[model samples]
Target chain A: MNPNVPDDSAAASRYAIEAVAEITHVSRRLIVVYCQHGLISPVATPEESGWLFDEEAIHRLRHIEHLRTEYGMNMAGVRMMLEMLGELEQLREEVRFRRGG
Target chain B: MPAAFKDYYTTLGLSKSATEVEIKKSFRKLARKYHPDVAKDKKTAEEKFKEINEANEVLSDPVKRKKYDELGANWQDGGGYRPPPGGRAGAGHRADGTPAQEFHFEGTGFSDFFEQFFGGAGRRNYGFPSGEQEFTADGGAGRARRGADIEGDILVTLEEAMLGTMRPISMQTADPRSGKAETHSFTVRIPAGATDGRRIRVPGKGAEGTGGGVAGDLYLRVRLAAHPDFRPRGADLYYDLDLAPWEAVLGEQVIVPGLSGAIKVRIPPGTASGQQLRVRAQGLPIGKSGDRGDLYVVSNIQIPTEMTDAERELWEKLKVASSFDPRSDSKT
Candidate 1:
């Protein structure tokens, strides 16, 4: 209930790359490729493990795969679209914040 | 939350150390003065009324008040809040902080600060108006009405969003007639391509409806986890590409790291600080589309705070030979 107290959710659930692949139905190779393109990132450190993904990364991976397969969009094009979408989301958020929402 | 902070105490006309009674008294006075229904300038009065309500809403509640006091005192110390070392950037969205009770609501008129900080907390004090009930007693069959809609945050991973998933939500409400608590669970379907702030609605899954009426829908707002390395501004991902003086002026191939391998990007000669080196198709995917965004490498030219003897000697030699004067453009 105390906001000053550090929340427990800070140590959130993180899945390894393999588990994320299983969850998202995205192949490990494609996931790694996405990582190479900087499309998605793993939260794990080198000393810790190969790759660890949180929920956000997993969602992004699925979204990436969906675009690749469903829309037939390449990585570069996908990146542009994503950027524009992200910008739109940001503006919406800003308006909400300004309005005290 | 926005960078601009609101002083709730000032809005409520109170000192930092005001008491609960004084807060209530002030809120009552302000409410009477600014009540939109009675005011000449209704539009302005409405804004004033909402402001005072938010002020009172936080100051009156103990938990919210404690959090505000901490932030208020911390802000007075003069610094933007930077999380302490190894704190995981502690994204305290409090997503799972969904109250187990059936106090669902919507359009409560909260500011960004209130929603960001004490958002996950229950707003039970905003008692339901009897007028909101859809039915009235007709001296016949019992009146029935739909329950208030529920709103709570759901922490969604990108993986789940892309694949579509069912998340379980449970609510316990006191049975009005029996006066006993009853718990019920429902699945909230998060569709594929669901993005942050998108609400996943579970039809007829909110608080129990009165007299066998249909239940209201439960709305779970999606919130994504924060990334440590890259920050997303729309689809474009931004990374601070740190560079040394020589690298900035002379240009060099710098190694930018990723999860699996490092990307060697060619930094052009005479590259200025803050210049963006964009890598195409190196960001996130668009909504249900094949379009991806670009990754922007924002150059940050850093000078070594401490230098070794040989490094200092080399810098001194370069300084003697160099024609560059950083302050040349300055008019002052």
Candidate 2:
């Protein structure tokens, strides 16, 4: 689950990946890959079989889509780029900590 | 149409059973090349893009591609494209040529070559395992239903509208089964020339089809909020060109704000109130040419509500010397 998305208290507000795929044009495989690759995680934990996704996943999937269609980057490429960007920020943070700024 | 095997492998520039990495890389390469912005030539780019998307649709899915590959030799020499006994000349018409049903691409152009080769029987009876049984009617009343179109709006500031900015708009969509309102957000790329009344259509983002029909679209109507200083017409912007009485008569180059940044407005000598000065190509964007409308500066002469003694003396002297008269031919 993304920390940025506020939690919905409504019991019926939740959904699974299969349902999310219908809303967004993202395939189930790609949605799974996003979770595995840490692009986006589900807001809720699954009780029995499949994982449950929330509205936040839909929002994040749209971001991933822009990177694909508009930017023309594939899922794997998007994952790698996002990882590198996160690393760069961490490195910047370390430097700042060292300088005590 | 014949059951010609559309080689998904060759379509993505891959062998029959290429690795996942190879397929993804190939798709990325093709997508960049055929992207609408990069490919300015619309007709060619659109054809290539559709081909790529069609290829990806099949190739990206393991099950579909596997099923397609299983029919191997059957598809090699156009095997599965057999028409049901008799051929219908026009699309969706019966073998008796009685016009069974009409097909619509809805004015959006598709490649004629593609339509010629793949448009016939292959598309009509694609009995995918998931939804095949739903439309198993022999001939009548079992057609798949298309989804309803969805509508949405995006709110932007006047400045954002003038220069154009991409904004992420959030929406609440109902879950099909649960009937829950799920919040979703997508960033829309706003064109530079977009105005308050302008609308953008994003295909395939609207409602899902009921049966197996094509999905509807999402229409984003742009709404621009008011600005403190600036107002816009179609492409041009309006601002009050406030000038001192002396500056209005003598004319001066005054700094003013434009869409990009500040610009100097050159007021000509002897300019009067309500006089409009045009600065070419300084307003909002005109279509794809990257040109814009002219900025119009309407002059307003300001009078001193309070004056210093020296200012009053100067005004008196000017009034005595000047031949210009107020109410000269008046009956007041």
Candidate 3:
């Protein structure tokens, strides 16, 4: 739970696509689709066999699932919305930086 | 249990006769404005968004709208309305004849009022089967099933977010046998650099699994509480630095409040109001990066509310001597 507390790089958990799908409740096909569409990238470079995802990828996939199932958005719309949300977050950071928050 | 009457039209700022298009328009506007993802005040925005969604759910559907209007009309006449036996509320079936079922919103927040009135219908519309198997394993019929995952919001302060902290959380889970709620309390360790909307998972701490199955995980959704001196956006922080006009013009080293403590910041000469100064690596920590974002200090030039005679004389002399005109280029 405290990934940074021990400062052990090897202690951080990494998941394959199957494990990511299980944890996030998203299908493997959809996860592959997301990666193919450049929505999310693997934490480490893919070997000849498989790709490994970090915890951030799991969170992002969960968010995408929420947008799709709960909000009833299409994949294209979800992708656009996620990009916009990222931009909006960066813009908010800039605004807060300017305000000296 | 009966729910209090809800005025959906008033919730959406619409009239009784509002059309479907009008309802859609209002719902979209409110949804975008208060979506928890984009809102600065997340807690309030989340509440508002739930209320708006519930309002939209009833108003946007023609059959539900008709029944709601009838109920509203009756309530208007009686000054208080109770559902008639075997009527809309008593007959637990939707307008489409689907049997009423308990709907669980999970992390998607809903209200008791919504549960009472339109919960079953919403489940049908959303295609969520009531009492659906949450996490099923492919074991034999007698095998235990994993417990359902539980989610709740936890409020954290700016300082606690920067440094790792522990929080006590009280959770209520329904007893499977008796159908009664049982409350349990425990402490959770939140890691440093936890940001707003971040989800922290505690393994095997959720509801007890049936038949000796493993317990589900508890997910705590982090919400950062408002700080008096700091405004946080992502990992960056902002603070307002107030200076007198003379100080702003003359430029001097000043003490400004920071998340940790007061830090000395140099104000360059001829500093203008609304100017921002950056202090790199002084903001909140990012997730496990071990590197901090920058802090921004905005300058606010202040004039004296009231001046002593001596100060007024000095100001008058300076005013006469100074040739600066802020409005010099403005056309009348």
Candidate 4:
């Protein structure tokens, strides 16, 4: 797990796809499928060989696995859930921003 | 986790023999009924809608449907589902009543069942068996794999965050292997000068090992709760210090509420409204450097809306005596 460096979040350490595959216990092929579905994005998508993933994407992948394996949701179902959850999160953020400190 | 057997077939008004197309059709029909936009009773409809959606989620997928069917083998004869005689227990205990012995972890947002049976690509198109599973081709045990890490969120008040505190947090998830919900509780010590959004790692407190392998770690993410007196920007604190118009113009010594305690700050003479007064090192701790970021006292000046006779006379005297015209400086 990576530490939360809010200032240098962009410069945070990244992991290769193979490392991510090992961490999530998911196949590289399935992770590519998830990318095709736009479920999660990579920190860097380089030419030919390697793609890098950060902590956020990894947590998201684990959540995806949790949704599928634990909650019994298919890709379509998981996609819908993610969309709804994302929208809900966005709404909450908007409310919090508007609320102000 | 489904504590009681929910009859998805009955919910959809379809039998076990219902085809895929029929399941879709029934789902669409009921979904329309409790669609939230069209439902008559909004409250009950919302709950009913969730039930309908859950039922559809299970029945629509072929693999999930198969698993659900297997779990509910005697759905027709069942009032409550007893754990299949010795099915899941086989993972932890063998046929000879010997403990097969695997690992367990108290994860943040997943069921223990998933961590046990389906975790790490048990039944997916993801290559094959698992990335970390220690099993041989002939169904024999192999090398042990380290347990997966667990992540969780914990709310920290700026007060507690600055001084550093240890908090006890407990995570509860359903354990399908034992057919019970398990709760694992532990205390996490947050170091002083902990930054917001930073993760505090508690070593080896994550999910248990798989096959006598080393256990994983638990990472607790700090979510700083909103404070009433101050707004933290990194280690710096922002305080809205309200002042009267006279106080803004003449300046005043005021008490600024610090994270640790009340701090006194002097508002410089001729301080204008919206001017920021900096109190150095009065904010929260910055990292582990033992230094604190500054506390900014933002001036919010207020003028009297309703004036008494005495105050109105004083204002009238000042208005005529003062030659200060702010509009002379600009063309707007």
TM-score on alpha carbons, each prediction: 0.47, 0.42, 0.59, 0.48
Candidate 3 per-residue C-alpha lDDT over B1-332 given as tens digits, one digit per residue, 9 for 90 to 100: 23467888998999998987787778767876876655899999867776776677678767678977877766634344565766555323445554432222233234445544554322222112111343235432466655544444555667778887665554445543355655555566767787766666655555455567666555555656544357677787878788999889999998887777778999999999989899988898877779997788889998899989999999889889989888988955
In model 1, what is the error at residue A30, expressed in angstroms?
Answer: 47
- TM-score leaderboard ranking: 3, 4, 1, 2
Candidate 2 clashing pairs? B2-B81, B3-B80, B3-B81, B147-B209
True contacts kept of each: 0.00, 0.00, 0.06, 0.01
Query: Which candidate number would show the highest lDDT if scored against the true structure?
Result: 3
For candidate 1, what is the DockQ? Answer: 0.02
Top-down lDDT ranking: 3, 4, 1, 2
Go through the candidates in order and give the clash count of each.
23, 4, 6, 2
- Name the weakest run of 10 consecutive residues (lDDT summed) in model 3 chain B: B122-131
Model 1, span B86-190: residue lDDT tens: 432122212233222333222233454555455552222111123123333441136564444445566554445445555544455554335576655544555
Measured by TM-score, how close is model 2 to the native structure? 0.42
Q: What interface-residue Cα RMSD does candidate 3 give after superposition? A: 10.2
Q: Model 1: residues >4 Å from true position, as ranges?
A: A1-101, B1-117, B120-141, B157-168, B171-179, B186-193, B255-264
Which of the two candidates, 2 or 3, achieves a greater DockQ against the reference?
3
lDDT of 2 by residue, B1-332 (tens): 22235565776788876875676668767766775445789678746655664565456556556645644533335335433344433233333444322222211222222233333112221111122222335421446544433333444445555566555445445543345555545555666677654545554545445546665545554544333244566677666688898888887989987767788888888889878888787787764457887787778787889999999999999999998876788945
User: Which runs in model 3 stand beyond 4 Å of their true positions?
Assistant: A1-14, A25-27, A39-56, A63-73, A80-101, B1-150, B175-177, B184-186, B203-217
| Deviation in Å, model 2, residue B150 alpha carbon | 3.4
Off by over 4 Å in 2: A1-101, B1-144, B158-164, B175-178, B326-332
Q: Number of clashes in model 4?
A: 2
- Looking at candidate 3, what TM-score does chain B attain? 0.55
